[model samples]
Target: MNILIVFNHPYEGSFCNSLLNSVQNGLKMASHSIDLIHLDKEEFNPVMSAQDLKAFRDRKPVDSQVISYQQRLEKADHLIFIFPIWWELMPALMKGFIDRVIFPGLAYDYANKSNTRMKPLLKRIKGVTVITTMNTPGFIYRWFFGNAIQRALIRGTFWKLGYKNRKWISYNRVKMVNQSKREEWLVKLEKQFSKF
Candidate 1:
């Protein structure tokens, strides 16, 4: 399997970065090819320019970066997103990456709009996994936002884009994570990626 790992953590020394390392090693041991993209290191502009937006919606050509990432997305068989939750949602950079990379014609087509049937562009991808952590508790998140990050990453986007067998592995209240719990989560993630 060709796996594309998208990382959004700003710090190279963070827990999310450590998680990425574990995921990469696990996937490699499972004989899967890995392509890692650290968003902060890349020159990705979150702001969609006026002319670019107009051209994109008008069926005209946009920047080459968008086209390039779209190609990566098309070729990926398994997609892994690594990020941390801020205010119960994805970071602005990751959200903006989705907006720019998952374009209209590339990710889906609006021409076939109807009441029922919707088109899916990423149907080729077999699995989508999200590895995220947060400072808040799971109970607090459930009571307030009801798994907003999971819904947005797994259901709202990937599922709609046709990535099957979606999975979410999140550790909440990271500020209180003990060494034992962290080790346990690392082992759990390794197991998950082995099956991927």
Candidate 2:
């Protein structure tokens, strides 16, 4: 399987980087080829300009990098997103990648005559998995904050785009977790994805 991992984090010392490594190691154990898109390292432009918006309306990608990302996605069988939730949402770069690359006529299209429904065009994709780390407690985030990350990424994005097989693994209160606990989580992640 070709797993496309879209990772968003500027700090190399962050735990998210460790999570990325853990997931990659698991995928390697499973003999799945990995394609990583480090958004910050690539210096991806998050803000959509006027021209970009115009191109978006036309269902066309104007940015060279976005086009390349689309090509990479086209070859992927499974998609993985690794990021840290900030302000109850993903970083702007990952959001922008979705806004630019996962556009109409490429990743999806209107399925009905009324244009009220969408059909996913990424038929090669079997599923999507999102891994996130956050400072807020999981219970609070889910009950109080309404799991905004899942709402935006899983339900709001992929499900609405007609990709039904979606999963999310969120590590909440990451800063409070002890080193041993974090290592355990990493081990579990590696074991889990090794079968993926």
Q: TM-score of predicted model 2?
A: 0.98
Error of 1 at 91 (Å): 0.7
Candidate 2, residue 99: how far the Cα is off, in Å: 1.2
1-196: candidate 1 lDDT, tens digit per residue = 8898889988988889879988988898899998887888986777778877886687554877767777788888888999999988999889988877777667766435562433667656778888898999998897888889767878888767666688888888887989888888888888777776
lDDT of each: 0.81, 0.93
Q: What RMSD does each model have against the real structure? A: 2.0, 0.8
Which portions of model 2 miss their true places by more than 4 Å? none
Itemize residue pairs with steric clashes in candidate 1. none
lDDT of 2 by residue, 1-196 (tens): 9999999999999999999999999999999999999999999998889988898889888889988998999999999999999999999998988888897888999988898899989899999999999999999999999989878889999999877789999998999989999999999999999988
* TM-score for candidate 1: 0.90
- What value of lDDT does candidate 2 attain over all alpha carbons? 0.93
Cα shift from native, residue 48, model 1 (Å): 2.0
